[model samples]
Target: MAKAMRTTPLGGTRQLRRWHRARILQAIRAEAGISRLRLARKLDLSPSVVTEAVAELLAEGLLVEKPLPPTGQGRPSVALDLEGECHGVLAWEIDLDRMAVALLNLRGEVRARAVLPPAPDSLSAALEQLQAATAPHLSGVRVLAAGLSIPGLLEPAQGHLTLAPNLGWADLPLLERFRAALEALGLNKTLAVVENEANAAAYGLYALGSLALEHCVYLSLGVGVGSGVVVKRSVYHGARFHAGEVGHISLDPQGPPCRCGKRGCAEAFLSLRRWQEAPTLARLGEMAERLAQLSAVVLATLDPERVVLGGPLVEATGEALLRLIQAKLPRYALSVHAPEQVALSPLGREAALLGVGALAADFFMEQMAYEEVS
Candidate 1:
């Protein structure tokens, strides 16, 4: 399958060193205040390689040395952290009810954030207002890229939306509109990305420095039921870029109609509005049943190391829903092999925005490495 947001291949010995340098920087970000010895151990690299990478990062002003805590033995260790406030990225999320914009520092801390005044009637109007609200935060900030999360079908690399049923938009050239808005505000140097909201959320959780899972499934239950799958450190985008449209997975062939002109799709049953207005026992049972079935499918098909349930529904229900979903997984699975761990997203409502920010951060680091090699 053709991948989304493909990275270029490394060439020759020097380029490979640059790639290793980038990986070292990411390791430092993941384990802040980590010593070179632990970094080499964690990344499975030699001590000399870690030392060389640390030196290059120090020269590039991306790392800062920290005084090691007392070891009470041998030689004192040296710890390193991401340099403070070197740069930042802008991350935006457009949901059904509202839109959010956040400015994140290099270390993924939010420096500034704001919720836009609801979503505008048109994509153009929404982009204009979002840009205006975001301009003030951009003052004196070097924004390397802008990450956009859309709650619909998207061409990630190009920021094009083929359809956003909730937004009443189809075939919208979102990146073009976003770029024009940025240009109007003279923020032309900032790179822009458009991606599916669920996908962004999945990546955001994956980028959390604490969690060390290699494979994860992020189920987003908001206006619709969607999922993002991450294998290793990258998102798995099927050839058609519709890999994780789990919302469209039909639960019944004879139930209610779906936006995709299908009957008894998962989206129809899992609508957050339906659950909120009349959350009867029967409704809750059905929700749990569908979720278990979906989780089982995920495990049988992908066998993710863990499954993370996130988005508005989980935010509202907290661990209650997580417990329910966990309870139902074993009963509904088609096979005996099931993931032992399933939980709620630690990133909470900020997963999508933070995910896009993480995406931008990785892209910026990659670009920097390529430049160094050149």
Candidate 2:
């Protein structure tokens, strides 16, 4: 048998630093072309601290100073924005029977994108196909990082997949594979991240300005139902990296079993796969009542800023799902009747992919800061 390759990411300490730096960059990224003074004010930090941070970032080429016009008035203010040309972060969305890749500049604006052939039977095969599809686009432009969103228990720290139910991926070194692939293409310098598809979608919603409410909840209705929590504009991955595994939250101990070894999870009750098994269950005329029970639990318990429902089925059912949730919600669910905030994601299909792009770009900027500071 071939010796098992070291699947885990090398340099553990570097990975930790990269994560810390990513968080810092996320904070500084809110404003467009922010001035040093303005950033300090917005972030409520001392001017000296801001200057130090900005100076280091500028040295790293992560940030560039926007030209300030000559105004023969008072002191001119210098604006800082992301340096897009420095590197690009790619986001891959691996869905059922389809593979999509998007190229985003360091500022998180999408530059270009294309779809790849859905041709693979195993993890290695899929990565190979993805590499082939991404080859032409990988020329010259520094694709220094990638964020992969797939349906599975993704071990981000290790850049490995604990399990991918839909695609039969298990214990695969997802990040390292991408790294190797990029290196093969002569684009060697980069970071690779694997995130749960649902959590990624929630973070995507936050980045896109749709789920603007600081305290928001996102429900990703897919082969399995997954939910995400955003408190104060950040995605909390939790201690065990399973914080938002809401699909496995037990709604009934006697109901169907979730892939994670739980029974009667919200997913079991509302999973699209479950509906597919028995088409009659999904027909609007028949299962309306069951969908209501399942949806209402999430709405009433979370009582979030808004309950956003996405994923293909949710998008297809659309407002009908919203109405069911509203009808089931107690008349006194919240103070004096603000119309039910249940909504289908307007961003639709591209939401998860864009979210991963934003996250990877943010990570790249953070690494630059650490490099400059060090």
Candidate 3:
């Protein structure tokens, strides 16, 4: 006998049904080919409740049933799985060099993708480019939501982009613009989520469920250095949503000038753009020392379980840079925090794109739950 989920009188029935559907879908996703009885036990729901929710999901084309082999059973059991082909979400990464778009199925598999050159200086041109690139893929697929990853400061609650120095974009209503773009493509019902590139990568790593911990830091090294902090699988946007601008941390007041108009900032020393020429051992050592200082600050402040290094620069340097950072981490981190606490990102340049895809998937699930409730 399973314990029934408790409910209150205020919108309790609707909420309960929605919760049951979400849990059933989540459980099926976690354990593909799960049986209804096993799902009932896993979720601690009564058979009737699970059956009702599963029926609704099956009818919605969100889930499918496959007959399982039987051994000494009165009837064959059916395995449940997500209907990946029928629905999907969109992921977009807007970078200084290009705009990458991908369509991912319910299982997080990339069904189609495109990479286009950087958008024109005009905002309307950028939106038009996005729509044109995305419209062709929406022919046979139903898009539930979209996630946009930008290399800039974003106020997600307000749907505004405060700044993207590299792209010369500032103080724009980015989310509204993206929604309008989707509407132009005949996806008015699709929800849109906006996030910083680093933040999106951090959450994507967490959502991947393979290389992430409860608390981790993703250090994005590229033209400009940045980091995203994930606490309990969510981005820890600090007060004013500027928590992860570690690149601006000043190591010296009179050193080289940074793009942020500050002297002696970490970005001035550590940005990949600064080291384009062939690097000598001495130069690598210098970069290592500066990165060690930045890592020290991050470990001292966040004390995250892991510090993941990512970006074009990291990929270019390969294992050598990771080794250098690992060797230097000991000088700054505590003894308990081993050098192994630092690692290179396995997802590489596609990290932000994949992260935004995961975000879109989550948003789609939430939308489905709310739609069911209504």
C-alpha RMSD between model 1 and the true structure: 3.6
**Pick by TM-score: which candidate is best?**
3
User: lDDT of each prediction vs. the true structure?
Assistant: 0.78, 0.66, 0.81
lDDT of 1 by residue, 120-208 (tens): 77888888777877888877777877778888887877778888888888998888887787778787877777778888878877676
Q: Identify the runs in model 2 with alpha carbons over 4 angstroms from their true place.
A: 1-28, 43-61, 67-72, 117-119, 238-240, 248-282, 285-291, 299-303, 331-339, 366-374
Q: Which candidate is the best by lDDT?
A: 3
Candidate 3 C-alpha RMSD relative to the actual structure: 3.5
| Evaluation by TM-score, superior candidate among 1 and 2 | 1
List the RMSD of every prediction in angstroms.
Answer: 3.6, 7.1, 3.5
Per-residue lDDT for 182 in model 3? 85
Order of models, best TM-score first: 3, 1, 2
Candidate 3 stretches greater than 4 Å from native: 1-10, 369-374
* Tens-digit lDDT string for candidate 3 (218-267): 98988888788888767788899998999999988998987778899988
Model 2 C-alpha lDDT per residue in residues 1-374, reported as the tens digit of each score = 00111122235655534433343355556666667777667656578767776776677666678756656888888878766764578888787646788888765677778887653677667767777767767665777678888877776767777877777778888778867876776767777677777767777777765456655667787677767666666666778777666677676799778767888777777766655666562454333444455455555665667667788667656677667666654542544323456677766877778878866765665454344332
Write down the TM-score for model 3: 0.93
